[model samples]
Target: MRYDTFLDEVLVKVKTYLAEDGTLASSRDSKSLAKTSDLKLPLEGSDLSSILVDIDDYLQKCVKTNHPNFMNPLWGGLNIAALAGEIIATLTNTSMYTFELAPLASLIERSILERMCEMVGFSNGGGTLTTGGSNGNMLGMLCARSRGEPLSQRRGIDGTKLAVYVSAESHYSVEMSANVLGIGLDNVIKVGCDDDGRMRPDKLVEEIERSIAEGQRPICVIATSGTTVRGAFDPLVELSEICHKNEIWLHVDAAWGGSCLFSIEHAKLMAGVELADSVCWDAHKLMGVPLICSAFLIKDLSLLRKVCSHGDAAHYLFHDETESDDLGRLSLQCGRRNDALKLFFAWRERGDSGWAKMVDGYMELAGHLESLVVEDPQLELMSSRQWTNVCFRFKAEEEEDASELNTEIRERLMQKGNYMISRSNIGEDVILRPVIANPGVTKESLEGLVAEVIAHGEDARRGIPSA
Candidate 1:
């Protein structure tokens, strides 16, 4: 078809989709419309119009996380500024590899990285925007690994076994980084956590000593600022001390909880974050930036350059570094997208005060959830209110079979499509996890979530599981 026709079609489709946003939260409609079968793919070439039809159908059927009642993952709600940045980014199609290719993106990225490092209290620091938290963690590990064994990059790990450490409750991406870095998973030590799920500094120290005694070289200690399972934060101050004294590279995987830096009360949870040699944060998670905007910031700017520098590669794109902007030297990727544009736009649009208010507002909502759990006689709070994730469970009427019944109730809720809450096994009992990372969720929405849980539990007791 003609370009004008395609443009008109795209605009019409976009407007149509926008109109359906309010009704996107209708679970009744979504459940009936959703397909469980495999999607068909075109074997031969198809027109853009045909593809658009299929795409729109799938999108409309999918859960709209941007909706007010759509609270599934960490991030939700839309930031107009970041959305605008995404459109510009797609149009530019610029790669951050060299100055000539992405001069303005490089500058924006540098400013964003600097501001992020400062938020983490890194005075002399620099970083690069990453694809997401996984990539950010990978970059952090890469930098740490390179710092320990400079020759490892050139010769590769032949026989040397370098160990990285994190709590048992830490994100799976830590081990993934070890695998990608060619360091075996066996070398990644999973230290024990305390009763509240926070990593025990003493256990960490013991693990490091054990690894060293077992003929393993301990190089990096990854402290989780926000663990995936429980949103538990390892004691950064104590862990940093242990890491620094032992000459281990300290890196904070604060991808989920990093936004707490914007909140005065919550930022205290990530105390001693500045002591780390490197930190990984996802702007998409708590900062409410668009997807694919995460950062891997190093305490020292030169360390990142040294780890990922491909010097002496004289190319047209990288030639005019002094005259143009370049961010490739300190990145894991060669052809990086303008992920910083949206994050930069988000920060600029909100300013510092607006961002802080947003963060503090979420914290208040989490606090409200904590109170709800505490007030309810049936629900028991598993973890203390740390950041925003609240882990709890529906208690049995008396103590006949609370644990098992609660676990069954959570399963039934998901199967029935009443509501969705994450489940976690803590100290032999499974608890419902309501992660309040979405800014769109309000008190009323959370109350509705509780009501749904109770209603589902009542159904489970009656032996009528939700369909």
Candidate 2:
């Protein structure tokens, strides 16, 4: 078939799938999936028809993330303009290294980064698009390391005992970044958090002082704007003051909650983000952009360039004319795709108001879900809804094995294919975590998910207990 016909067929399939859904996926079992596709590589090329058939089979087994039933992950639904930009990017197959190779693409990327920096309240800041939010978090630590020990970039650390600090509820990427940056995991300190999951500013100051007295050089403090499981925003305003007073690098990992910047009602969620030296934001999470679009924005453009790259890494690739226009000069990566275009086109189509509207809707939906849990007799709320995530526990009064029972309920949900909400361990309790990230998700669907979960828990308790 022609490429156009093939593309048309894929769109049709997507539309049909979006229109009809019961469970989130047809199958979530490893054994069933293993039989769905041939494992071994074929020696000879297969016909287009056979390959298309194989593609259909693969898609059939995939989780319908665009479906309203999908609430297991922090991303859902689709943005038409972002999908268009993705197709264009694929067709061009261009990298965002230099203007000579991708002039329009590089320009587009620069514009997006500049806009994001400004959104963070920077007057003249700059940044780069990272592979993902995790990589962006890593970039934050790398920059802090470079600034603290400039020689560490070339000669490496000499066991000076550099340290990193973050809230107890921050994303694990901060610790992973510490490991990657040669700051041993042992030196990565976890600060205390209050009941709302926001990092306590006083605890952060105490930790930094404690590290200093111990002769450890505290280089960075990562304040999470939105945590992975709780959808909690750290106390950025208070944390900023502590970091500034102590001369520590403050990086805000706002991957899941950064979309609040677009909403007039929710912008307070990210208040004082401007005080942070750097930030990591993912458009794919709350903005409805496609997957893998994350920004590592820094307050100082020159510092990012100095810390992340040397002036002349590749003479052959970096030409004089492209020097000023090149994006690779400041990026931690090379041969990067034009992922910015996905968010760029999506933002342009909807503009600020449109995106803010979506954010407002999600926030409203989250509140609604929280109320549903509050009214349900069989359910107990684990934590308050801070953003779009509503976490609760399934408890039939006096059930001591509720955690184990809840796990069984989740597994059964996956097996039954009626809903797909995830579960998380908040402290000691295992609670069901449902994030309202899907633009297409409805109030009725969310209510159904709650009812179905309670039903599953009731059923699990009736059977043999899960080990």
Backbone clashes in each candidate structure, one number apiece? 0, 1
Per-candidate TM equals 0.90, 0.96
Q: What is the lDDT of residue 143 in candidate 1?
A: 78
Per-residue lDDT for 198-278 in model 1, tens only?
Answer: 989999889888888888888888888887767888898999889889999998999998988887767888999999988
Scored by TM-score, the top model is 2
Write candidate 2's Cα lDDT for 323-430 as tens digits. 788888988777788898888999999998898899999999999999999998888888877899898988855745878878888888877887888879999888
Q: Evaluate all candidate structures by whole-model CA lDDT and list the values in order.
A: 0.80, 0.85
Displacement of the residue 331 alpha carbon in candidate 2, Å: 1.0
Model 1 stretches astray by more than 4 angstroms: 1-52, 158-160, 311-317, 320-324, 397-404, 415-418
